[model samples]
Target: LKFVCFNNDGIDEHMVWLIGLKNIFARQLPNMPKEYIVRLVMDRTHKSVMIVRHNHVVGGITYRPYLSQKFGEIAFCAITADEQVKGYGTRLMNHLKQHARDVDGLTHFLTYADNNAVGYFIKQGFTKEIYLDKDRWQGYIKDYDGGILMECKMDPKLPYTD
Candidate 1:
């Protein structure tokens, strides 16, 4: 698998990648232009973005700054349908966690994902925080069976790398 990394600067390409991610993240189209997202991804203070591969575009992640300032939330992460369960998802998670820790100096990471992904995050060292009803979800809740929140402390002692 190819691990491609890019930010919002590449508007068209990023939007195309986001479209493919819709299903996995259960997010609705915002109607905002790609430039808006590019701005967020380009923001030096509050956010970051990473695309998994240039060709496959198998997965990508968006992280937003958290209350702690040094930490961030895994706002959105997705692996294409066909690429699921082939280790791309796990690799993507590892990459983002490392990025948040090593590159950004963030110690905590969080996510709210469908049940299908809860175990995956758990396996990656995240601990479940709570389970939220489908109604509480803001986007694409109807598309998923259920939702769960998880968090983990990013420490160098962990085997994962940036």
Candidate 2:
């Protein structure tokens, strides 16, 4: 797996992931800009972006740094449609969490997930903090679906060893 910054040449890869994200929001949102995908990809810091693949990108995730927070936000995470639910997401998340713990001074990682993803996040030990009952995400979220904000703590609680 290689961590790559967004290059204009990566449009195709970004589009593939963006479509998946938009599809998740389609039920409540409308008219997603294809350019937004490119913008988000390009705007991310090089070190914070990662693509996992042996040869070509099979999956990818982005970490956007946020203020008043130590851990960056897990912005976009996608595994190819054909590769979903096959443990790629879990592997990607584990890598992301470790990167935050070992490299970045991250104590917590956060994201807004949809109905289908809540269970996945929970299985990863992420707990729900609050549910935005309505479309609090406005242009970003779909009106028909509620948005769940979840967080995973990164501070490892280990037994004290004298």
Candidate 3:
């Protein structure tokens, strides 16, 4: 699998890749509201890293930095259902960790892990955290009951690798 940093200038290409993976979120993350997903896709504040196989987009991750560039949140990440459990997610996440560290100079990464994805995030070095900044979420996160807030502190000495 190959990964590409999304080019902001290529809106059409970004939409094509995003549309291709729309079903994965719709089906896998049913609890997540559709409006939120659409907003994430339409918003330019976020940056994305896409996974490609044979020149076709297979998966991707979208994220954005907080007011403080040292911190950021992963808005969405998904691989085709057929491709799950094959270490693709790990590779994507590792790429994200590296990008966050090298390009953004970020020290921490945060995200809301759905029920089914909690364990996966844990395995990827994220730990549960109490991030109570409702303003930061734009009221998108009401209660932490449905999902878990996870954070990964990047260690400069350790390399993120699959």
Best by lDDT: 3
Instruction: Give the lowest summed-lDDT range of ten residues in model 2.
Output: 133-142
Specify the highest-TM-score model's number. 3
| lDDT value, residue 121 of candidate 2 | 88
Better of 1 and 2 by lDDT: 1
Error of 2 at 85 (Å): 1.7
Candidate 1 vs candidate 2: the TM-score winner is 2
Candidate 1 local lDDT, 1-162, one digit each (tens): 445444445578655654455433443323324555454445544343444455435567767654345556665666666666787767777777766676667777656665666777888888886333333333422232245767677776575744
The whole-model C-alpha lDDT of candidate 3 against the native structure comes to: 0.74
Overall lDDT per candidate, in order of appearance: 0.58, 0.55, 0.74
Q: In model 1, where do residues sit more than 4 Å from their true spots?
A: 10-54, 129-146, 157-159
lDDT of candidate 3 at residue 18, scale 0 to 100: 64
Candidate rank order under TM-score: 3, 2, 1
* Pairs in clash, predicted candidate 2: 28-142, 28-143, 29-142
lDDT of candidate 2 vs native? 0.55
- The lDDT-based order of candidates, best leading, equals 3, 1, 2
